[model samples]
Target: MTGPARGGADPGVAAAFRETMAAVCAPVAVMTGLEGGLPHGTTVSAFASLSMNPPMVLVALDRTSELLALVRRTRRFGLNLLGAGQAGLARRFAAKGGAAKFAGVAWEPHAGVPRIPGSAGFVGCTVAGLAHGGDHLIVLGNVVAAETTGDAPLVYHRRTFGTPAALPEVSG
Candidate 1:
């Protein structure tokens, strides 16, 4: 990678940054919103809880992503945390098919946003603020509703989808 990648960042630095981040496991999720009563979503791994007092979360979406634009206007969105067994579903949303991606998938509106069934967790949020990041926009949301299914979460590591496991304890 000698030149810039698709987002126009230095390829060398971008590749290195990606590889470095890949070493750390991150949760896999689909950020979902509605466009005129039609569901739209995309896979995202850059989301995290920002605060507990006010119950806030933040997700980073590509600046040019249609889902980002939709959420901006709707002022609401859902984060469906994928379970360990939902790698195929993750890829489905990650692919570039637009509205066509939800053709055969199952989801419904919950707490004013679309929620995918059988996910590890779900959180419906209202957009609180937005900030510009390099190549991505940080959306700060006030969590309105949340639930968990207690399923093991899917994770991304080393450019692959996987499940997290506990390490064996060691004593000397």
Candidate 2:
């Protein structure tokens, strides 16, 4: 095999795991919540649909994430799926800015959460459950509301921001 084996404390294991995950093309999004009635958000790639019958989703946040505290307090959050043109926004939210991130950003209150304009999709949710997973906490949510504009989605792959491309057509 390439890197270390799947076992004990080899430092390269962490690096190898990160490198492997970096090869995955994941959607870029901002997970937002309210603190003191003000908005706080952070960019994340670890989001996914968990259920369809009841409309549920899961997002993994770092254990030290400030927004995680907000979700714990408010029991609500918004998943804002970014458009391909929003790489700048994704970087902005990825930075360390509590309420300051929304300073110049134009967003509106929608279904009890901050909804940024021009996103590919938005999902307003109530925190349903929490689980400890290594260095991250998986937050399960029941989607209370959702919307989509059909915009091209932003994605991250190979340690860089990007969008997916369609495969070439194959003629019979």
Candidate 3:
């Protein structure tokens, strides 16, 4: 609703906000966009379903990220929801300034975007619009194609990756 402080938010306020937000668990996903026939991607925790009727999803990316630029240019992208065992892939994509992030990674093309193999789920989307959100760009995508696997979703919580623990069985 209201914007951040005009001049600058207080350091303590920002720290408190970060600390609080860190406790909230979120799904980990790799957002991929094509760049000159090569795949460019980044790990994203700021992603969520936005609508159902038209099948829309939202992902927030750093404003200056190269992957964001590619998505802006191509107007399309892929989102791969990682499985618990895919932490290595997540770390790889999260790294910066690499020769090729896709090197040694398993992926396939989906609607011209690269989708990580073995991910819990993957979706191909066309950018509907972008919104400025502080240092990030909120990308709203219309899901054109998507698929899901049986694998458990990888989750980010307290700045770490994990999978949800199984629930205890009960008999009524």
Candidate with the greatest lDDT versus the true structure: 1
- Report lDDT per candidate: 0.93, 0.91, 0.90
Model 1 has a clash total of 0
lDDT of 1 at 130: 99
| TM-scores for every candidate against the unseen true structure | 0.92, 0.93, 0.91
Candidate 3: how large is its RMSD? 3.4
Model 1 TM:
0.92
- When sorted by TM-score, best at the front, the candidate numbers are 2, 1, 3
| Model 2 lDDT tens row, 34-104 | 76679889999999999998999999999999999889989999999999999999999999979999999
- Ranking of all candidate structures by their lDDT, best first: 1, 2, 3
Weakest 10 consecutive residues of candidate 2 by summed lDDT: 1-10
Q: List the residue pairs that clash in candidate 2.
A: none
By TM-score, who's the top model here? 2
Q: List, residue by residue over 1-172, the lDDT tens digit for candidate 1.
A: 2777776888788878878998998999999998778999999999999999899999999989999999999999999999999999899999887778899999999988889999999999999999998889999999999999999999999989999898999999
Q: Is candidate 1 or candidate 3 better by TM-score?
A: 1
- Tens digits of lDDT, candidate 3, 1-172: 5455644787678879999999999999999988677888899999999999999999999888888888999999999999999898888999984329888887778888998889999989999999998889999999999999989999999999999998899989
Q: Give me candidate 2's TM-score against the actual structure.
A: 0.93
